[model samples]
Target: MAFFRQLVGKILKNFNDRLSVSAAAALAFAVFCVLKAKGKPKFPFVNLSNFMLVLQKKLVEEVIFDGSHILFRCVNQAQWHVTQAEPMIRGKELFKSLVQYRCQFK
Candidate 1:
């Protein structure tokens, strides 16, 4: 996803007419958006005995998953970063992101 995003950024930079450039570049941009798959899990290793242990509370609240989009409210923060908001992941990725988000406190 990052590769495609950087590639699209490079592609967009070559175009002279930014306003009327809706040809091949537009299709490439569309393809980049479509590549938003549920990426691999990014959680840390945990011992078998401590698998159910939670170190921190959830930062996000009231998650709503209605098919395509996942909407959720964020808790108060000193700085509103990407972790404060939902990453548009579904099912497994959602769980991974939730874990990653809460793990910041630990």
Candidate 2:
């Protein structure tokens, strides 16, 4: 997404006559970016910034992420109870361990 935005920005910057790059910064962690078109009568200030990457999930009986931790992974009706989770950059998860799982669902 960021790459596509940047690519478009570059094309618009070099070839666009009346296209002024407009951008919005999300409240979540994000990177705001803009085009840098030099040699203009007035130099254009184009910087890109994107704040955060979020992956929200809804489980069988509840909406997750309301709390600060992920207790389990709900794939369909199956819940892989997460006993341990490894930390990653910016609180993103890439690894987890579920040693023991118990579920009784009707």
Query: Quick one: best TM-score, which candidate?
Result: 1
lDDT of 1: 0.49
- What's the true lDDT of residue 11 in model 2? 53
Provide TM-scores for the models.
0.24, 0.16
Q: Report the lDDT tens digits of candidate 1 across residue range 1-106.
A: 5986886686677567666467657867677566644454333333322321322545544444443433344466332212212234456566567556667765
Q: Which ten residues in a row have the lowest lDDT in candidate 2?
A: 46-55
Give the Å error, residue 72, model 1. Answer: 20
Residue pairs with clashing backbones, model 1: none
Report clashes for each candidate as comma-separated counts: 0, 15
Best by lDDT: 1
